[model samples]
Target: MTERVYYTSDALEMETDVVSCTRQEDGRFHVVLSATLFHPQGGGQPSDRGTINGVPLLQAIQDGHTLVHIMEGPVQPGKAHLLVDAEVRNLHTRYHSAGHIIGLAGEKFGWLGVKGNHKPGDGRIVFDALATPEPMTIEALATEIGALVQRSESRIITEAEGKRLVTWGTLKPYACGGTHVLNTAEIGDIRLIKMKEKKGQLSVQYELDA
Candidate 1:
């Protein structure tokens, strides 16, 4: 299993040991590191992009408890340098934090979040509701979310139970494992782009200002 450095720190780069490298049938090398700063594609957030041993990493995915770093070039079993793309990391962090903000807004507006997608260009949260509730307009949601972002009180906290929680101001603590900004202020402006209801699910789509 790879030590997940991303859990404790948001450092964009690190030096770690390559535990093993295996060639997959897809023609990519699956590199496992003793520790890594790479955030795998999980928890509605995308994978971190960068290089392992100076070779571009194609993707990072979780295989059971292990995080697999896929690359086009072969890496030997020894010391290696891990570098995460700063720009991509920043964008993912911002989007993920925005999702949490919107989730808080949903709770404030009596909507229960059943799922979330923090991916760039297609970020959204799906809520479970019995009926299409009023005040579901994009304008109303944007207004509420904007207020939360303006407060700039979001912070990450670790509980005695060992769960990492992200709290925005006085709202309820949300358990999340993905990377995020230090505060809601870093999320900047958010725009509600779409909202739809299907099969008793309310999907609220949003995007961050460039």
Candidate 2:
């Protein structure tokens, strides 16, 4: 199995041995490394884009226990360097961290966060109401989340099952595999786009101020 370096360290560059590199029918190459700082496309987050051995990386996909990195060309199966696009990584992490803050605020309003989509321009969090929420508005929820974001620092802890538990400051922890900011303060201004409730579920769409 490929060791996921992003799980512990958010470093944008690293070096690792290339276990294998094979050409696919589409002319692209599938490269496997000993470990990866590239976060694969999963868990409501997009795949990381960068260069491996100077070759443009397309994306990283999980094939069972191993991560197969798709690249524009092949590099020799040996020690290789990786450089992740900082802008992309930072934007994705901001969306992910913001989602968690929103979830926390929702919980305080009698909603249990159940699902999320942290993709750019389409960020959202879905929740299930446990008890009738004391009349809350989008502005109020945004204010609540903003308060937490200001003082929230992210912490990653490992469990026996090897799952990464992410927590912001003293708030609750969540089992997540996506990249996140070191602190919620880096998430920037969160703007609630829209909120809708249907079929006993509440979906809140949000965006970040550029």
Global fold similarity of model 1 (TM-score): 0.93
Q: Compare the candidates by lDDT and give the number of the best one.
A: 2
Model 2, stretches more than 4 Å misplaced?
A: 152-161
Q: Give lDDT for model 1.
A: 0.86
Candidate 1 regions with alpha-carbon error over 4 angstroms: 130-134
**What do the candidate models score in CA lDDT, each in turn?**
0.86, 0.89
Of candidate 2, the 10-residue stretch with the lowest lDDT total is 152-161
**Number of clashes in every candidate structure?**
0, 0
Q: After superposition, how far is residue 32 of candidate 1 from its true place, in Å?
A: 0.8
Model 2 Cα lDDT, one tens digit per residue, 30-138: 9999999999998889899999999999999988888999999997899999999999999998999889999999999899899999998999999998868766689
lDDT of 1 by residue, 43-76 (tens): 9999999998899998899988888999988999
Candidate 2: give the clashing pairs: none
Clashing pairs in 1: none
Candidate 1 local lDDT, residue 6:
89
